[model samples]
Target: MMILKLLAPIILFAIAILQGLFAEKINKIKWLKITLICLLLGSLTVGLIIISLDEKNANNFSKQQKDNIDSLRIENAQLKNNLDSLHRALTKGMDDRSLQEIELNKKVSELNIKLEPFVKLALTKYPAYDLQSALNKIAQDIENAKKLAEPPILIPNAQEISRDKTGLNMLLQFKLSKNQSLGQIIFYAEIEDGSTAKIVEFWPSTKGGAFNSGPDSKMIAPDGKSSRLIYSLIGAGNPTFDLKVTKAVTVRITSNYLPEPFITKIE
Candidate 1:
């Protein structure tokens, strides 16, 4: 069909040329004229069929290209929608994280506000609250108090009382008026084994004279346990005791204006 279509126009032109060249001779034969006319008509019909088929094929190809382009556009639109969805999810997550951070900051601020009063109170009550030295001193005091609470063991015949000796001393200080004077005071000491005695011969200095106990006064010995004693002294210059014990002992001293026992250890 393609060969016929390609040669149709040439055949028509050749027929016309042949007719022209042998016009007088061909015209003289009716059959030859009729044959030439039929050949021309056949060539024209074949050319028209080829042209119609080519137009139909071009239309189909154009439709197929249009369909492919439309499909590509649809796929691109779907991809764009997916990207937009992903972007929206990421944005939402970021927003959520920001909100969480803001909430956390707000909670911290609220907590600080709530603790403001307590912080101020602590600062006022403990001026050196944040100081490491103050903290260490407090810890040491607590440890010492704990040690004082523990009971101690006494060594037999190992206790003695001495004067003008420097050992563990408990100095009692007092604030008094000049008009007021100290009266006769008594010293009492209790040992760890439930034994009690009147502490004598221990003189603590005063403003006017020294507070001295008689030699006949009983001597209270510490038994490496808790012991209590009471005395009366006035006018600033109070007496201190030189404690000597064979073993560790806790001494509780009570004097004038000193209701609470001042506890100490002699090691």
Candidate 2:
């Protein structure tokens, strides 16, 4: 635009000189008409050049504006995508946290249910106690109960040893100090004359019942002195011993609850 402004005056001056020289060579009226035509052409040429340059500049500006709009659109799309991704990630994280909390609560509930019985028992036993103290007291009480329920540990004492020669049998009497339920007893006999005595049957005079003995499941003791014969009898009984022995024999009676054995000699 600045270059066009500077050249406009120069172009007008050159046109005016050409027209003046032509006016001197032609008639006055014709010379005036020719000068008017030259001035009109020069103005038209300058106007066309200004319009062309303006159009070129306008086109360049429009192209740049379009490019800027396109860039902004792309940036806006990218921002939207990023925001969507962040939203999804946050939602998933919150869901995971909620699930974890639910699982933890469920486990706690199950544990509380399992402990409810013990808690009630403790509260009933110890009215004035904290939870921990009550639980400890409950455990100690359970241990005491187990100890009390155990059977008494005592060695058997054999008395009133007599033999009946007519029946060919021996009667041995024993009793448990504390009147408890009867347990199993294992007994065997060793003959003095180095003969093996096998027990065939056992009969007790006590009202409980006849004693039970198994001859098929007999086993020898580790010391080889007596054969193992198991008998189930009442706590107190005078059981008649029927054995296939021709010589004098010593009978030994033992039980799981006894620390020692009861022994009796019959001749």
Candidate 3:
């Protein structure tokens, strides 16, 4: 669009053209017609110039907007590509972690199977103190192999607590048997000032037994009549019918093969 900016020059140009075309054409000099023609031509020229300038400005503005839109589209594409790459990397890491966890579980299962037989054999024989100790150690080893795992020995053993007066005789008795071969016996007993103690934690000490005796094909329980090897008579080891004891004491016994145990108390 184009427009005439010099308003006075456009008016003079329009008047000259009107004079050249109609000065001699009028009968008695028509002043109304002449002025009307000059005024109309002047207005048209100015309107055209303004319209041209407005069109040019509008075109320039549109081009600038298009350029900005193109630049934004390119930036958006780059960001989308970056996001996709990060997603793929994170997916790969998750897959690797899943695979590692599966392998570790399989290994643990295998180890547990291997340890089962040794534990079973130890309990079956003589059902003595050492055999039970070995069973406990095996369970401990299993626990150490795994991180943040519970102790296998959480399963309670035979435990009891009792009190006896200074002059009164106290007796310890148990029914014992073996499900496996004759392994050495292991026993635990403890004397405490108070009768109350956490039976599972406060393990008793052992007194008498062929503790570490190896491969005893023949085993005997002191009572013989009981058939199964019930070793303790008075204390955890042995004593007569009347024995003096002070304070309260607890005792616990375990055999590797047997699921059950022997427990008694005296004070």
Q: Specify the highest-lDDT model's number.
A: 2
Q: What lDDT score belongs to each candidate, Candidate 1 first? A: 0.57, 0.65, 0.48
Q: Deviation in angstroms for 41 in model 2?
A: 6.1
- Candidate closest to the true structure, highest TM-score: 2
**TM-score of every candidate:** 0.39, 0.40, 0.37
Which candidate, 1 or 3, has the higher lDDT?
1
Q: Tens-digit lDDT track for model 1 on 1-267?
A: 679777998999999899889999888999999999899899999899899988998999999999999999999999999999999999999999999999999999999898676566555656866855554555576688876654331112123333343333333334432334445444433334332322222334343245545554334544333333334444434334333433334555554434454454434
For candidate 2, give the lDDT: 0.65
Residue 255 displacement in candidate 1 (angstroms):
45
Mind giving the per-residue lDDT tens digits that candidate 3 earns over 168-225?
Answer: 2333322333122232333333333444332222111343222222333223333221
Q: Where's the lowest-lDDT run of ten residues in candidate 1?
A: 151-160
In model 1, state the lDDT of residue 100.
100
Order the candidates by lDDT, highest first.
Answer: 2, 1, 3
Q: What is the lDDT of residue 91 in candidate 2?
A: 100
In the order shown, the candidates' Cα RMSDs to the true structure are: 16.7, 15.2, 14.5
lDDT of candidate 1 at residue 194, scale 0 to 100: 38
